[model samples]
Target chain A: MATLELRRLRKRYAGGAEVLHDIELNIDHGEMIVVVGPSGCGKSTLLRMVAGLETISSGEIVINGECVNAQEPAERDIAMVFQNYALYPHMSVFDNLAYSLKNRRTPKDEISRRVNETAQLLDIAALLDRKPRQLSGGQRQRVAMGRAVIRQPQVFLFDEPLSNLDASLRVQMRQDIRALQKRLDITSLYVTHDQTEAMTMADRLVVMNAGRIEQIGTPMTLFRKPATRFVAGFIGSPAMNFLSGNAGDLPGWLPRVPEETTEPLTGDISIGIRPEHIALTTPNAGQIDGHIELVEPLGSESLVHVRPTGHESRLVVRHVGTEQPDAGQRTGLNLQGPFHLFDHHGQRLATRPRLADTTCSMEP
Target chain B: MRYHRPGLDVAAHTLLIIGALAFMLPVILAVLASTQSPGTLFSGTLPLSFGTSGLDHYMTLLTEPVRGVGVPAWRLMLNSLLMALGIAVGKLTIAMLAAYALVFFRFPFRRCCFWLIFMTLMLPIEVRIVPTYGVVAELGLLDSYPGLVLPLLASATATFLFRQFFLTLPPELMEAARIDGAGPWRFFIDILLPLSRTNIAALFVIMFIYGWNQYLWPLVTITSADHATLVTSLKRLTIATDGTPPWHLATAMTVLALLPPVVVIILMQRWFIKGLVDTEK
Candidate 1:
């Protein structure tokens, strides 16, 4: 395993349009850094650039202190698991795992031994002689993983490797990949668009938007204190609710924060609070008054969509338990502490740091 | 399934049987004529009865040189086989390489090069036979296998077929191979060639028949009777400038000429259909 670093990495197409803007990251040995973003956010491009499959417009990718900007992908000694598995269609499972070893001129006997070892490790020993098409989607995914791990390269690159499977299979493979990476202790850089997968699998998550790294931190750090509104909105399930007014507009909103860091809330600002953080009280009992517009029950919790008075947007309040307000019933949205305040430019405001930490620690 | 109609089924069977007989009758007539003696063949109005000179006629044709054409039937068949195999293998090689370069690599004027190759589909050997023969003669490749096969090797049809096949392959396969430490040549040989086996077999069947049936190009280029192909020799045997044409030998040679292509088609029939229709990748 090796330390992988991306410093001021940028990518620009021949048409002079930039896709990745100064991406700077450092992945330590045995750390799995998952880059999560929407489509066209350049996360896959970033992974490809590190794999040497794409040209770096500028900056250097240093793996184990060696700059691999000029090296071929083979010379870089990195294995990548593509989203579609990308298994050799005509080659059997054993040959697919053994292809790189054979290309590297490994001895035939050693290749077979290593291939069998990998097959056994993946629990695909019976599938060694079967071609990729003969295998199911989950089987193919295992073969793809086996191909990467058998090489034991300096680093592993995964480009949304679990996105192709069904919902249950994706979750299973997500855990499988995480456990495999942990067991092998290989430094890995994985890219995906699924926020839940990122939250569950990444040692540290790099949340990206519009070709820029919005925030990079542990999954809990990103969930608790997203550095920007985009990260706030992108990192969570059911997403954080963004209100069009200042947090100061709600009565008793500022008093909840500690007095030391609570500045006079002024200027055009947006308030973001997690769906689970907002509490539903009687109409007019809370900070802002609203009528529940819709309620979607999801087993253990419910998503309550409430429209604040004289507002066009709906705030999705994640209410725990099966009890939910009726769609047309008046409900008061209490502005719980640990609120995210964003400036007009969607940048996170610098207030409420102390209250955020205290409330974050207090939550279950 | 569509509704089963007994009357339509009977009509369809009648039409198919007639079509099958229409196709098979000439071949049967040729086989029967090859077995007949010269006197019986000349006396005849469609001699359906089998004659006794079948072995003798075949032996004579196979062992001795024809009257006008100076090469034995086996030698002509051998030349035709060499030409067919050469053209089939050479066309596939050149076309595969051309398609590989076109599809996989990025170069300046790559599309232009592809279009230039595609334009050759408009000019077949028959259309460009004069200049082709000129080039062959100038290169002193006349009366050689290369002369017979070289002019037909730039197969735009084969190249297009391969390019289409290559395009259907996902681009991720190439990236995966590259990450696995396979260079361009290794990837081509180990991955691309094996994947293209069915396509190569299909094209071989087509190009072999095409090369075997080539008449005008070989006839124009080959002056030596020893280098004459079976098709061209058949023409020589029919248009005997000195006397009545050797119909018996011509029929026997025609029968022999049909065997190789038929065998190739039958052997590769499965792959030929799969290559055209199967979306295995």
Candidate 2:
């Protein structure tokens, strides 16, 4: 019955710049929700608000069955891991982990037990007595995680915890965090600007844009059916390629809607298709054609950038192989994936396009 | 170091040695003169050789301490020690908490408050000594240690230094402590104080010396022998109402007054250097 709910949460500065607007979320017990967006998206602000580090302008935050809006962070029974790994430079790793427990007046023996268990869990037992300055970046990150875990708090707040590490270390720590969060089954709210981290680590991803929730769902659901054009463009890697065509079907689009149809997509409607969804076909063989501009072969899969024959916009196709066409080649792009169409207002089109007749199973 | 000229290096070394000896000559002269007869002072010719009566002079000042112009030597030294330690600790306490408030907490007109405190630095005890003395007398603290220490604490130099240091501390540490269930004071004592060790040590040395060298305020305010400080007493020991002052006894008192400050600096030198260097780093 454990639950964390954010109802009508809003944040505005004294200058009346609203940074978070109507953020409504229900995070059940043991759920790991990663709030992700571009810079200045207020994702970190939302997390800090829930952690009681920032005040909510007008809202109620319910943890379990109690409203903790006015409670101090310590009384709220939550823990936070910061981006800089804010380890106390003076204390050893052991003391860092034992800090909260010690502050709570936990018995000395219990403090040692909890610190030892957390260090062992994070595989940092050997570095227990070393100062934070003595450890490497990855080790410090682990200690930060251990500090949060030692308290056994009801919720965990992470503010871009892996953003400071090297590339390889970032990847490793992402897995470590996900595994640890699952093992503890702690209700956690993680924030990051990296789409990959959001997708890989989140049980449910909250997509924010310009101070509002664009969409919230599992990573697979958001990837397959992004509710808004921004979500579609932001969810996938290399971002979903967007093309605005004239009233008619643009290049790389299936010619499903008849020219004299009763209702048609009008008024600057845009199409969103993932780069991996577009496939390469022979010249003039596919539903639409384009001229290949650049082909970036990344060993296993290649990204082929093409300027559609009819529209001035360029689209990318994630071709899955070492073999790919070169630049300046005339090719047909198969418009076969789940097509996302946005209206002139950038809202997702309510109905999926009935263009499956011309689609092929090009799932390479 | 990269472009060292042999001749210039030799010339520079010779100049620095001469400068070092030049600075030491006055101290050496005072010591030699203090060893001679008590009456040998301010004469056209100065004594260069040491006399055998140096111990007798210091003993006279420390034990016999000429009748009634000042307090006993041991009592004056104790008073000075208490005053120095009190001021050093008091300034640090007030400065650290004030800097904490100025840096970590947001209030109305915090900048205005900091600037107002900073304005006091220009008005040392010298400029406002009369007003300060009246205030002390009004409060019935003319001969109290608090009177001596409180006025000095109003200076903002240490507060400014600490504010700069506290500003450099990552804000996340505060947030982290807050999340860890540490209240403001707990955070200060547990984490902030530990991190500020070197800075505190350095401030202790400087404040001790400043407190030890305070002669004007003590001389003006402390009219009793009970609260007479070492520096003021040394000055009083130099004057004679009816005859030439005793040079040997005055110099011996000066030499005794220098010991505590030098000892403090020597003890805290390591932390002083490390704290100053590592803070910005």
Candidate 3:
């Protein structure tokens, strides 16, 4: 219901060590922004700062066009669903859902109506009287969601809320939360270390590393066009392959090398290619011939690990369908034109437009 | 998994019966002595049979004043009840508030304050009875209920137990409450106090019994018979210095004194176990 803006947001501990640095993000109204990062990357810290749980070292947090930097969490008109649910252990489900309403001094009958409505919405109408300990993990998650949603706050802040559930339950709750957020049309800020969850849940993902945002874009844009070497590695499962070599001494076997760039490709360059973008061909027929070292079959697709000639490291080629090249078979790797090129500084270099135009069916 | 050894079962039952009888012997003797007349009590080698004067003795103890002390048994029972209830309620309140402040707030020297409170465990009322009595007397609390209860009010053991229990609560609960628009006082009254119900129940049973059994402090401070507690008055009933002691009335008073604590333990025993087990973290 409200747009959340973090301008120059930074977090520093009393010991003078910075955990979050110059985080600038602007979330649109009714949009779900997932801040994805590795552990200790300060994604949760950034979310906590937005929630008013942590002090803002130097920044302005604006919600609904009002500056909330000095406001308390309650005064900021926000509700947070913690990673562990954080439901009051002694309270029943009904009471947990009705807590914020009662705190705001709502009428008795109105509070009961809203609580019943919320419980019905969550399909937990039968669990009104049971304490938190008696409920299963998924039921607890529903109650936690009910607790946050019943208030109808300006923004919902989720601090890795689905991380505690089992795998199957995590998937189900992830979809349920996405549907619920859409139905309510509430702006939400979710933090998680799981890239798959972020890729599916976020309208736009804020990929953070070492307290700074590496990129802020849609899932498809981030996956297809990573701006840095770190984003290229962090965004995809099975990760992208990186090969380093001198730029001026480009081997003849290298496929579709960037013909030109504003910055001179002089000292060294790295080639980044997605595992799915490399097709295995007959050895000595395609560019960069190598022998397949191993094949990891994962039902529909199998990842074939290849060792290129004169290279110590192995390159993984993600091949679609169950049929895969056998281990120890010699195969030539064909580069699908859209592979990335990074300079010596690990920054992505501008490539020709035709290379980015190859149709990608696997882009989620 | 089911062990159905008849011989071992019989042997185990026999041992359990012996242990139970050994523990209940003193209480059984007290009940028996209370039932008998003084002459019947002194006549035999600890008579196992009940005397016919049981009803008469109990009625006299309940309705009439004791011969030398001139105070009804009910009055001493009421005094002990007040002292026990007072100490239990007072200790729980102080301990809970102290523990709440220690665990939830980040004030200056909070740990130092906790350690100072913890240090009092070494200086129990028995260890510092003289100085405690001096303070109570100087404050004009002698021969008053306050004198008996106030000196035993500061319980370091209960405070420590509460602090440990409070520390087991997740910090996220407090943050959630804050985001839910609950201030500190609301959080304490609504969330914390309700969550601490089992802990308070367990501590109440303990502190009540501890205060009821207090002998040395009441004996030192309470000079007037009007303010005598059950345990202190029982001492006066036996050590007469002039004539044969009224063993029947003293035994009757002892039986009365044992009822409240037993009833309390039986009532709160379930919650006491649950509290200890639930807050183990």
Candidate 4:
């Protein structure tokens, strides 16, 4: 319903430490962007700034092509659902939903109608008379959502709205939120530290680290083509493994690198291969050989941890019940699929360049 | 359910019974003495038996006007009630708003303002009675209900108690309301006020008693009998009478003065405990 643009957004505290650097992002109408990051990554601060709950230290926030940097939260025509389900504890579910409309001077009958519709949509009609404390966690979460949706604002902001729910409820609410968002076709910006939620629910994922955007793209695109060493290791469950080596040696261990990158051979390279991309083969059958250190069976697929010869860090392999290597057994790892390679500065180096690229060589 | 200890139970029950009797003895003796004439009190032994003149003495105390005391009993009771209610309601309003501002707003020198209010806790009306009386007199609030109520309005304990409650409130609620288009006044009336009802009730009980028991301030502030509280009027009934202590109507007035606070405590025993301990929401 609305497009949101953050132009060179930055947040600096009074103590002179910048918590969020110039974060530039643009969202199309009806797009759901999930900002995923670690705890101190400033994702929540960014969301709050968009919600107008936090003051912007610099830059502009434009919603629906109208600059709202100086506007109040209510004046921004946005509604937010909080992680703790911040439904008013003293108000009934119906009153909670009706609060914003009543404040806007909506007709009483119209307010009641909208509340009823939202309650029915959220499947919380039976809970309208109950106080927040009387309801269960998931029920309260629905009421929180209902409160926001009843306003029918142009944009919705969710700050880890499912973080407090149980794991099963979290999964259920995740799908419910996505379905609701699509059904209403409302623009949303959801923030969470859970990568799975980001991958499953986001139309685009904005991966952040240490106050900066590491990468922003679709989940699969970011998964397959990460832009930095941080994004490569962050977006996956059993995070991508990085092996440090020279570019000339990448074709031997990680065949994902292209040929003819004859940069100075002394430059260090961080080669990343996802755990699932590596295959288990007999010793002497592949380019790299290692001894299995542990086997973790995860029902569908088992993660095999191996200590590659001459390397101190252990590399993991995902196997689908085939060629399961045991403890202290010698195995060969075939990393013939696509992988990520970064330089010492953590910026991703080019792969599949038609000719020798100057970017990798410019790292020095 | 936690344990089964017969000896401890017996010891505890026995000690509690003796303690209860020890506390109730003075009130019981006062009730019995109010039914008797002043001569029986001079007989040296405490009266254990009820007297025949109970209704007569109470009726006279309620209906008849006493010498040297300018106000009647019922009017004095009315004034006391008004003063206590006014003080309780007034203090709660001021303290709750002060606490709400202190907890929710970020202003310059907010901590300084809070500590200044907190410093008033050390100086009760009894300690600063003269100065407070001087201010009240200068303002011409003397001999008025506002005079009785205004000087003792500010309550640091109630303010801090409400401040603690407001601090425990999650900040997300405020943000959600803000996002819901609730201005500050709407949020306070619709959200904060209802949330603070229990704390207000508890503080009301405590403050009402505090205002009801104001003896020194009322003595210093109110020279007119029309404005005297029941607590101050109770002193007028103590005739001394060659140190025999009249003992009859004096006991009746004492009983009357003690009833309101005791009734309040018993009526709100549950909320009183919750308010005092603050162990629940």
Candidate 5:
């Protein structure tokens, strides 16, 4: 177990074009930090740098209080699970898990003991003698996990390990991975493009966009109070709705806008609210009126798409059960308390602090 | 599924049958001549008759010697096998290592080196024959096995095929091995090489056939009769005196020289086609 600290970590190609810029993060021992982003956001690049598969263009990576930027992957004492489950296709499961120990020249008995224990823990003991091609996707994923477990490295790096499995298997394996990580108490960094996986798995979530960290917090903290407009839009399923409305038009539910705004709201000031936070009421009982455009019933919950009058923005509301207003039906939308407001530059703006004792306050 | 045009299929089959027979006619003639007596050869009276059906001519050719050569036929067979094995193994191993380096590693001028090597494939060996002969003689390797084997060791065709094959492999496999504490050499030998057995087998068969049928290079290099390979020795046996040739014995010796490459092709016919098809993909 070790604390991994990356101070001003940077990466660039040989011609000096930067891919990752000025990354600073500290991962405490036994913490699972899930890095989530879009495809070209450099999450995988950052993981590869930590695993020593890629060269760091600058900055120091310290593992367990020792700088490991100059060390080889093997010398850095870390293990990784790849998205394809990169098991040696020709080797049996036993040999696949035993390879690292064999490379280190561990005694035969010790290697067998460790491999058997890992297989039992992963519930893949029956598959020990089978080649990787013979196993299904989920079984192959377990074999990949077993290969990393037997080594018991100081940190485990996962690069979308569950992305290759089917939907049901992905959920099962995700839970299994979290449970295993907790039981072993290993420091881990997991990279994925799926926000749900990051939300459900990480002790801390790092939301990235365009090679920069947009926000870093607990999963609920990110959901409740995103630091930037990009993080707010990138962390949710239907994505937070952004309405180009004047701050002064929000009526009395919102606090009064500062007279001399430190960061002036020019052009289009954006207001963001989660889909589930918007409520439907009688036509005259709410602040804004819109007509329902589409209704998607997801059994337990429904999504209502609304087009507000005199505004080009489309708002989505999460309604419960199968009960939903018909398309073209006029309805009212009430903004939940303390919505996120952003300036034209997409940076979050300051709002008045909520009353501490108000139980219905939106600040989490 | 059946073709919609029956007439076109029938025409296609007819053309294919004629082409197939055209290809098989020479081999059929060679086999028929190998069984005929030396006296009946070149009579052109009855080419495929069963009159002389025994292996008597094959026995005579195997035991007898050409008048000027003074060497039995078995010695020529041994020399050919040795040369073919040496050249095949040498070329395949060197091509594999070079292809592995070009595919996996990063170094200065790597692309330049690959292009230089690949450019050799466009230049025919016949164009460089005189310069190659001079270099072989200056190195004092004329009339030697090293002289025959070393010049053919670097095969751009084989290197290009293997490099293209290696390029399609997913990089994640190599990355997994690195994270598992395997070094570059270990990762290649343990992971990449095992997955490439089909390719190696395919290259082996192709290189073997090429070395077995080689005529021009060996003809220019070897001067002594003892150092001559099978094809050159067979040529010496066929040029007889009195402007008349012993067609039966000459055909038998030709069959002997063709046997190994034929057997290799039959055994690995599937892999040979696979190698060619994989290159296009």
Candidate 6:
């Protein structure tokens, strides 16, 4: 296992504009880092650069303290699981898992032993003779994983490997992958656009936007204290609601907004509040009043969409149980314990107390 | 409720039957002509008369002088096989390598090279025949297997078809193979080529038929009748007029010439359609 460091990595297609900018990330040994972003955000490009599928335009990718920028993917000693589960359609599952070993000229008996062991680990021993086309989506996914696992390379790279599976299968495979990674403790870099997958499965979540790193921290740290408005909005399901309210409108129960120095908040500043943090209360007890636009109930919880009076912004609140107010009914919103405050430039202000606050403190 | 369409179905089936009959007509005529004696073939008397019983035609083709040239039909058949197989193997190897490069590499001037190669498709061999002949003659490849095969080796049609095929293949397959420690050649042999069996089979059938039926190039290049392919030999045999055209033996020879390609098409019919259809998808 090796720590993979990408130092100011940049990628630009021939005669085309740059797709990725100066990306600097250090993946420590035995760490599982998930690069999460939206489509066309260059997450896949970054992963491909590390895998040697893409050429490094202007920077170095050092793996195990050696610069692999000039090396072929084969010489890099990495294994990758592709999103589409790129199993050889013509080969049986056994052959698919054994292909890499055979290519490396491994001994026949050892190849068989390793393949069989991986097949068993993936619970696909009975499917050894089946081709990829014959397998279901989930089975093909396991076969793709098995193909990578049998190699036991220095690093594992997954490019949205579970995105092809059904929801239940994706959840199951997510747990299986986490368990496998923890057990093997291989340095792995997983790329996905799914924020939940990144949040649940990563040792560190590298949130990206527009070919730039928005934030890199533990999942909870990112959720609680995102370093930018982009991270606050992108890292959660239903997304964090951004309110364009001034400091004068700050609720008395919540912490005071950070004072502006040198650069005053003359323009618009964004206040980020996650759905679950916002509470629905009686009109007199709440800070802001709005009419309920919609309520999406999920058995134990409900998402209440509220449009505050005289404001263009609609806020979503996650309330527990089926206790939901009727649509078009005037309701009040109570800002909860933690909220993210961002300047007009989208930089988070250092008002909250958290580990991610260190960087914010130095910014001012 | 949807209205039932009666006349449309009847018209569709009628048109389809007519199209099927039109396509089957040649094979039916060939089968019937092969069975008839030479004297009765073009007699145009009865449409379906069982002609004079004959292993004579088959035996005659085995022994008869083809045209005034005295080239045995069996030798011509063997020549056709050698030329076709040579062309098929050569075209497949070159096309696969070229296609693989175009699909998965980033060398300098790559797109420009691809466009230049692809541009050759617009200029058919007919357009370049005279110049091609001059080049072949200048290189002294005339009347040899290299003369017959080399000009056809760099097939833009096969390269184009294989490129389209390889482009549809998930890029991840190549990436996965590379990360598994397989170099470009290893990836091609172990991953890309194996997954491309249907495409290779389809291209093989198409190239074999093309080589088997090639007349213009071989006709101009091959000076020796012994080295001549079946199509050229057939042209000579049919146009000879030394004696009564041995129509029965000639038909049998034609049948022999058609057999290999026909068998290939039949055997690989599934993969041929699969390759074409999957590529469209």
C-alpha local distance difference test of each model: 0.88, 0.85, 0.89, 0.85, 0.84, 0.83
lDDT of 5: 0.84
DockQ of every candidate: 0.79, 0.65, 0.56, 0.70, 0.50, 0.51
lDDT of 2 by residue, B1-281 (tens): 54568898898889999999999887787778778875455565666898768677777877874554555688888889999998899999999999999999999999999999899888888999889888888998888888877777754998999999999899999999999999999999998898889889989999999999998988887888888898888767766776767777877777788889989999999877776665421
A206-228 per-residue lDDT for model 4 (tens digits) = 99999999999999999988999
Quickly count the clashes in candidate 4.
Answer: 0
Against the true structure, what is every candidate's RMSD?
Answer: 3.1, 3.1, 3.4, 3.9, 3.7, 4.9
Which pairs, if any, clash in model 1?
Answer: A275-A318
Q: Give fnat for candidates 1, 2 and onward, in order.
A: 0.78, 0.78, 0.72, 0.83, 0.72, 0.76
lDDT-best of 4 and 5: 4
DockQ of 1: 0.79
Give the docking tier of candidate 1: medium
Candidate 3, superposed: residue stretches over 4 Å from native? A246-252, A256-262, A355-364, B1-15, B270-281
Best by DockQ: 1
Q: Please identify which of the two predictions, 1 or 4, would achieve the higher lDDT against the true structure.
A: 1
Q: If the candidates were sorted by their DockQ against the true structure, best first, what order would they fall in?
A: 1, 4, 2, 3, 6, 5
* Better model by DockQ: candidate 3 vs candidate 6: 3
DockQ of 4: 0.70
Evaluation by DockQ, superior candidate among 1 and 5: 1
Model 4 chain B: worst 10 consecutive residues (lDDT sum): B272-281
The TM-scores, chain A only, for the candidates as listed are 0.93, 0.93, 0.94, 0.92, 0.92, 0.92
Model 3 chain B: weakest 10-residue lDDT segment is B272-281
Candidate 6 at B250: error in angstroms?
Answer: 3.6
lDDT digits (tens) for residues A257-319 of candidate 2 = 223133466777777778987778897677677899998888999889998886677888899
Q: TM-score per candidate, in order?
A: 0.95, 0.93, 0.94, 0.94, 0.91, 0.88
Instruction: Report clash pairs, candidate 6.
Output: none
* Best candidate according to TM-score: 1
lDDT for each residue of candidate 1 in A221-318, tens digit (9 for 90 to 100): 99998889999999999999886664456434333532333556566677777888788888867767888889999989999999888778888988
| Of 1 and 2, the candidate ranking higher by TM-score | 1
Model 3, residue B143: C-alpha shift (Å): 2.0
